[model samples]
Target: MLAGKRILLIIGGGIAAYKSLDLIRRLRERGAAVTPVLTRAGAEFVTPLSVSALAGEKVFTDLFDLTDEAEMGHIQLSRSADLVVVAPATADLMAKMAHGHANDLASTLLMATDTQVLIAPAMNVRMWEHPATRRNLAQLLADGIRVVGPNAGDMACGEYGPGRLSEPLEIVAAIETALGQGSLTGKRILVTSGPTHEPIDPVRYIANRSSGAQGTAIAHALAALGAHVIFVTGPADVPPPQGVQVVRIETAQQMLQAVEAALPADAAVFAAAVADWRVASSSGSKIKKDAGRLPVLEFAENPDILATVSQRKADRPGLVVGFAAETDDVIANATAKRARKGCDWIVANDVSPATGIMGGTENAVHLITAHGREDWPRMSKQDVAARLATRIAQALG
Candidate 1:
């Protein structure tokens, strides 16, 4: 999709800088040429030789290299590529870019470049959430720079939250979205993913076994088709996709609120495995386990987000797709679910332990719709996403 594209990749200083090597391979696989510029601190983690080897081009490092300057001026270097991408765009690098500082070759090229810029930020959780970093991010976005990921998870510092760099494929998807011809352009879609956590106390909760790989793939596929996506996700094993607005939530109720806030979408896909019940009167503190006494737990039904959105009286989406994770009578169960929930379509899959579909990489799904059911062959989750996204585009049209 990115054939003939020339990408100038700027590797910033962060532990996530190592992923930049893999990003080069992904970009080159899609027929884009990568020209890498490594920062001083970035060189600390990865050697220039490795970057050059993977990118298949000489790595540029210094602003005052007389020989390199004679070969290609900074102005020429900055504007030479079709796109400028900064992977592991550290806080310092972003601050410099936001303020147009050019102390180093990376910042200098970023400032002097006339081409479009995309950054994938990586820092500690605290740094990423800091006011200074927030200001820099806002400024960068306001200046028309595209961003990919700083996914929330366990960090290298034993801290957890949003600050990790996106995976290689996610970054590549972002690059494709930035450069590819729009297929679902101007369309807005809402997608929910992962397993919601229903808190029972300060230290415990209820969740599911959803790996979130399928939903993440779907979001990426839709984004690749040029649709503006609102991704409302819960605590998932896999990180969310790139190039979409991600709203993280913990409970089903919060997911409903976030989904409602992203209103009037063209379609809504409920891929998340939300808990059906929550603690009615969860203890404020952890419930102590007694040797002989048993504790009573009361449960209440959680919000049915798919049903609520599908049965909306006003401003309902043109297409509302829901998933049925059934172990037996998949088609019958999903068909019944479609009619009962008032959704336009239902994606049914057998998640039995024998099939290993719950947390596996592949899926065998039956798409149930008003017209009838279509049984798709077993395929990778990514393939399933692509086919479903294409069908959605056709349906919306």
Candidate 2:
């Protein structure tokens, strides 16, 4: 899809700038031309020579380059690309982009560009979570700017949170979505991911080992196929995919409400590992460790989100899919779940500790349908998501 496309690549100042080199190679390998624009501060991390070598073109810098400015180079450069991508979009650059500060070449080009823009943010965890950055992110999304990641991981600063630049392939996928090519074009899909936290006390909760990798991958695949995605996620270890409307929740009840609110979609995928039960009356304050005698806790069954959505009579999606993560009787239990939930399909998997499928990268699953079951080989979560997305597109058609 990217063949012959022109990508205006802007390198921002951050440790993640090194990833931009890999990004250029990935884009070029897929037949996209990259034009590199390095910020003055960005040059501190990645030299202009390396960027020029990867892009096989002259690097653009300095707003006052008399040679290029004589012909209004900035405007021409901005308008010439099919898409504008900013890797390692630092806090300063994001702030500049948000408030329309055009003192530098990179920000000036971003201000002048009419092409669709996608950014992969990278920064310290604190900076990324700051109110100012959050406000800027909101503004950018509101302006239709696409965002990929600042995926949570250990950072160069020895702190860990959501500030690492997305891997090169992930950025490539986001670029594909931004470019608007896919089988599920014009479709809107809902995906729920992660393990819901059922609060038992102010600081404790019932949860699972779900990392939400599969669900995140499914959302990414759907978006790459040109689907509008409403991602309702619990406290997921992984960040939500790019190009989706994210709704974060902490409990099954909240997840259900979020799903209902984002209803009237073309399809829905329930991949969250919601807690089956919660404390009937959780303490508002932290439960003291030395509270004399052992406190007895009453448990209440959590709401069944998948069943509610699947059984909805109004605003029901054309396709409703549920997941069955079992440690025993994987096939029998999942088949029974399909019959019980009334969902169109159930993706069954053995998430037994022995299988290591719960929080692992690879998954072996069974596709259970009204017709029959298809035993699939163990594969990476991303491959499974892509396959399922293709099936969904066919089903929708």
TM-score of each: 0.57, 0.59
| Model 1 alpha-carbon drift over 4 Å, by segment | 1-181
- List, residue by residue over 1-397, the lDDT tens digit for candidate 1: 5789999999998889999999999899879999999999999999999999998999999999998789667888899898999999999999999898989899999989999899999999999999999999999999999898778789889999999998777677577666643668999999999999998999999888999889998999898889999999999999999899999999999999999999999998999999999999889999999999998889999999999999997879999999999989898999999999999999999999999889888899999999999998786687678668877877887
Please name the candidate that would achieve the greatest TM-score relative to the true structure: 2
Model 2 clashing-pair count: 0
How do the residues 34-71 of candidate 2 rate in per-residue lDDT, one tens digit apiece?
99999998999999999999999999989999999999
> What value of lDDT does candidate 2 attain over all alpha carbons?
0.91
| Decoy 2 TM-score against native | 0.59
Give lDDT: candidate 2, residue 283.
96
Cα deviation of 312, candidate 2, in Å: 24
RMSD of 1: 9.4
Which candidate ranks first by lDDT, i.e. highest?
2
